[model samples]
Target: MDKSTEEKIYEAARKVFILKGMEGARMQEIADEAGMNKALLHYYFRNKENLFKAVFKDIFTKFFAKLKDTLLSSATTREKLTVFIDNYIDLITANPYVPSFIINEINRDPKVLSSLMFENFMEPAKVLKLFFNEVESANKSVVDPRHILTSLMGMLVFPFVARPILQMVLFQDDKVAYNNFLEERKEVVKNMMFKLIEI
Candidate 1:
């Protein structure tokens, strides 16, 4: 029961923090969002900063865990990459501000991110091995895993972070259309990536 209640508070706090950021989020707003009392929220988290840290760490931890699982799975490279992109897009859509939120947090305090996450959240060796194996099997020496990873991040994240500009300039502020565009990007990104790595 306590664990479940904590999750509820985390979910509510995540939404509030992502929506309004750390400085703007209020305890009552989080309580209201969680359908709990302000005192109960404090009982669980003590204050907004603590709650923010917990939520920030919790969400990213789970997010990267999913990605790592996909990497470590027995699935084919294409399958792994597809699932990886799908999960990443899903998280970005749900928590749109995460990329920017992370950037701002890191800029604010460089040590904050390292302290928040587990030591082994991402293992560079496993990740590089997976991508390199794919490249070697395809016999494509020219295809760079580094490029794919960097490009994938930009393609997936740029749309969400630049939402206001893109939605206004190209989308004309059409919410549904812009969202549909993002949803469609899952496959579009997959196909584009497939072209690079798939034999």
Candidate 2:
């Protein structure tokens, strides 16, 4: 029961923090959202900052776990990229607010951003660099793997991140259309990547 209540507070705190932001949210609001009293909220988290940190770290860890496995596994470079894109898209699509939540919080605290950047979050970039090094060492005729990675990131991440505007300009508020766009992208991204590498 204690653990369950704590989880409820955390969930409510996360929702309030992401929606209203750390500066704008209040303990009472979180308490109300959690269906608990403000005293109960303080009992679990000392303050909004502490609660925000817990929520931010939890979300960041989940995001990086997917990246870490895809990058560190024994998959081929192309295979890794494909898996990464699909996994990444799946995550963001399910949690549409996640990108905004992350970007907003990072803008507020760059130090936190730097810490995450240097941490396990960078596994994908490191993997791409290693792949580039391997192909170059073998004297294989290929464009830079970094370029391929960048292109894939652009193709996959940009659409999801820019969804608000794209919804207006391109997708036209049709959720089905946006979904189809993403579905097509799974193959479109792979083909574009293969073309970029000429492999």
Candidate 3:
């Protein structure tokens, strides 16, 4: 099957970035990997940083609307949590690069994620407030909103972030088995977090 120009560029960019790291990667290399010229790559993405952000945002924009809606809705913490875990894990499994892309950007520049989340993704305050509001609501299992927020996020994202090590150590580098573990994690995480928060 043929790939679109943007898809080709994204795939090429991801490969180059992985091999050389973002700072060391060059657009010419990505263009070469994509079987295109530098000018054509520039036509789609003006610069390396732009290309990088475009790649990540392409995935984020697809899911941000649903995430925003669930976070902002007046649903109980349990209800919102179920939706969040389901959608989030679905996203991670579908795009395994999503978590690493985010973590790499954060590592590249600490403030980058803050900028991405606050300015690009959604206002940080509203997300933070979602947790606090949950505590105030009749379902009061979420007293430590900040802790819950960080813990839930860590729980959801850690396995993917640590996939290489976990896959090697826990599953003897069995890719399919490791993936099954992650898939099973959806229900496991939900049940464990619910138990923790008593929500």
Please provide, for model 1 over 1-199, each residue's C-alpha lDDT reduced to its tens digit, 9 standing for 90 to 100: 5558888888889988767777788899999998888998889888777888888777667666666766667467777777878988998887688877766666877766788545644474467576667755763656566676788789988998889999999889999999999999999999987776654
Report the CA-based lDDT of candidate 1 relative to the real structure.
Answer: 0.78
**Model 3 per-residue lDDT tens digits across residues 90-163:** 87777676667657766877764554575655564677586667644633564566776787889989999899
Clashes of each: 0, 0, 0
Q: Total backbone clashes of model 3?
A: 0
lDDT of each: 0.78, 0.75, 0.75
Error of 2 at 81 (Å): 1.8
- Between candidates 1 and 2, the lDDT winner: 1
Q: Where does model 3 exceed 4 Å of error? A: 1-21, 43-46, 53-65, 72-74, 114-118, 121-124, 135-142
TM-score of 3: 0.76
- Superposed Cα deviation of residue 173, candidate 3 (Å): 1.9
**Model 1: CA > 4 A from native:** 1-7, 117-125, 136-144
Candidate achieving higher TM-score, 1 or 3: 1
Cα RMSD, each candidate: 3.0, 3.0, 3.5
lDDT score of residue 197 within candidate 1: 65
lDDT of 2 by residue, 62-87 (tens): 87677767766745666766787678
| Model 1: lowest-lDDT 10 consecutive positions | 116-125
